[model samples]
Target: MLKRRPLAVLLGLALLSGCATLGEGGASRLDLIRQRRSLRCGVSGKIPGFSYLQTDGSYSGLDVDLCKAFAAAFVPETGAVDYRPLTAPERFTALRTGEIDLLSRNTTMNLSRDAAGGNGLSFAPVVFHDGQGLMVTTDSGINRLEDLQGQSICVGSGTTTEQNLNDAFEARGIAYTPIKYQDLNQVVAGYLQGRCQAMTSDRSQLAAARSGFADPRRHRILEEVLSKEPLAPASVGGDQRLADAMRWVVYALITAEELGITQATVQRRYNEAKRRPELTRLRRFFGIDAGLGEKLGLNDDFVVKVIRATGHYGEIYNRNLGPQSQVPIPRGLNRLGRDGGVMVAPPFQ
Candidate 1:
């Protein structure tokens, strides 16, 4: 016959176990963010049209807008983001360790990254469909990947960009020296300082780098694309609530664009949604109906807040990468599917 432990002792042990779970992976990420009052977002603060720190003392770009969209969905500040500037190697570790609530850095969605055996991140929808390409000085006469044979090329380390560069060169029976850097800024410096004959990155990035040069026309990006880069926002794999909320935040951006809602138009749309019971889709989208935001553990006005903060997906893109913007890459594949591009989202219902 064994004596039973005190009820207080048993309760203490259970609470300690719960606390331990919350210490690492047991707590809900959504709950954590709400409690913390700000979204810890990882971003590459070097890419101009994607995510960059501006001279005016604020972060701005397509990725920054995505971060704002996420923050606006939950926090009251509309753009309550504690931005964590991270390099390629540092980004995934930050997410997996719960250091960040989300990663809005222009990261690619790949099998190794999304798999549990790998980085174990859940990717949001593809926001930008890009391709890797090479950039060379106009004087180099390196018009094609074949022209890069036997030349030293610069690339960002710890990224698929490097692997794709190697695979492309090797498959072509070409040999080149790789000068790698941990940061995109360093890669650009190495290229500009003549450390390499050519540099490679996502073609949009190549355009961005060129736009800032002393003479933009002096550098030219090659027509040869190395690999497809479908860039998206990412989160650590375990939390379903966090994952689901992020998925819809991204979809809300796209859906708003498809439905012709912008920052200026969202308020009126919200009023329309509130007054009308007949517009089922619009009402559900703006959270006028019951069940949309509740399912995600967020307020019903979440999408409204998101749109008011960052407008729609198209607005974010155009603000950073449009014709008047710094890097004007044509929206070949970044447009809505109905607009002849491949971006589409699930219905609000």
Candidate 2:
């Protein structure tokens, strides 16, 4: 207090503090990923169609497919991917600490997350369009949200589901009790044990959970969608190149769907594309000439590798959430733009 610091000294101190807040300054995340030779992806292994740990010690689901796609883009032939199973509360922390290179978990993108500071995290393109919903036993006789005025609901802790449930019920002047658990399995158990009359979560998640019941037909998901949940892959912020690479990897899936490319169709398309180089977009996508992948510091044929590893967006959807899967969800808002849905990819050019 005796002497005032000069403006230059104050400014320099502020600059140093700002740099400290940003964490360690080191090599680019991309270089580290290449050196590691495998993409480490965080996922929620509880949900069936989104991300689940199989009995055979393998991860399977739509989000897992995205992880594989990312790995294929970076690692040479049959790229390597390491799946880290995380819970709702664990995913963001893992991403911020660099424990995981990417988060393919089924996380909802919202204002708070987008504006969150100090963690240096940002969401990529929306991978799945979903909404919050509720499920109850089929014989509960509670057909609507308004009917549950004094009932207990099971929900996952540290998730938007609880807040959304409170908001929706309060807006409707409905009073309810919430039993929160740390994970999906606990929530399901709480619901199944009669501690809660209903379970609330993303509609897709509810469907996935219900599918695990001894008789799935004993439960029914309510039709009312409480909140909009645009799910996407999240990566650490402050690195635009790494973010761009993750974004384009998602876009490639959409673009491949638009182009009618699939695991089965990739070989044929490659041969045809080679014969007719006039298809500029296709050519550039498959690395017939230098293109977006090169610009993103990825292999020129990254899209090809991604497609070969995980198929297109529609194929991933069908394999995980369509008729053949344990949790079959309708592709209402997830279909391609041409099919009356919101999914559309920007042109490769």
Candidate 3:
């Protein structure tokens, strides 16, 4: 006969298993967000085209719109939000400590940042597809990454930007000095102040920073991309409920774009869905039939709320980083898969 464990030992094991289950399915963060009546969102307040504080004491940018979208989805019509401007180093800590419910900064999703044994953050779908690039003064005669082999590069500290810089330069056997700052604003300042010959960041960010300069034409982003940076929103890991809700929220943005559901056309599409019961996908997407949003622990009409608050992903992008915006980045890989870009979303069904 197989030997049985001691009574106390078996009880202890059972208790431990129960505790683990509780930790996994504990008091839902989604419920807390609903009860709190607002979302505490973290963002890099200094990045111009991503998230910036305006003269009118308002926040505007793609990331800012994302926060509003989340608030709209979670809090319904009012879209109440508390914007917490966080530095590169402070973003993760704030999320983990419950200081913020969502981090919509231009943060890259990497293995270390998403892994359970690492930063333990659950990331939403990528909202921005960017690449690391080196920005140098147009008159510097630097046309490529190798040109800065012996020069100092200004970079934001404690970010994937810095790591990608080192990796790219090292792989190419290009040695350089790095002047690090606590955040992107400081890094841009250091570059403008002549503390470094070049500044490295997401190419789109470089364009954003350049546009703010007195002479924007003086800076040029190198064509050689250093690395792929798929930026997304993040929340503290282990909250599957919150993660599920956030993931689907982002997917809603993409799905809206894929379905040609513009802000002005959302209600039209909803009406069509209502009148035509055969439009199965549109019916479920707009919450006319429910299920999708409820599966993520959100109101069935959250997608409709999000779109009304922030528009679809393309609209948000064009409004922030398109030609008319201060920071204009060609929607290279950010376009929909059908539009020859890589972005796509799962079916609402």
Best by TM-score: 2
lDDT of 1 by residue, 1-349 (tens): 1345577789999868744643585767888888888999999999889888989878988889999999998785545899999999999878766688899888989999999777778998898888988888889878788888789999997668888998999999999999989988999999999999998888888888788888876887776778888999999887888889989999999999999999999998889878888998998899888779999999987999999999999999899888677776667678899988899999988
Provide the lDDT at 316 for model 2.
96
The Cα error of candidate 1 at residue 346, in Å, is: 0.8
Candidate 3 lands at a TM-score of: 0.77
lDDT of 3 at 50: 92
> Worst lDDT window (10 residues) for model 3?
17-26
User: What's the true lDDT of residue 188 in model 2?
Assistant: 93
- RMSD of every candidate to native, in Å, equals 7.4, 5.2, 6.9
**Model 2 C-alpha lDDT per residue in residues 69-183, reported as the tens digit of each score:** 8888877554888889998888877877678988999987777676646445778899898988888898999899998989999999765778898899999999999998899
User: Each model's number of backbone clashes?
Assistant: 0, 0, 0
- Scored against the true structure, residue 280 in model 1 reaches a CA lDDT of 89
Worst 10 residues of 2 by lDDT: 111-120
Candidate 2: segments with Cα more than 4 A from true spot = 1-23, 116-118, 135-200, 217-224
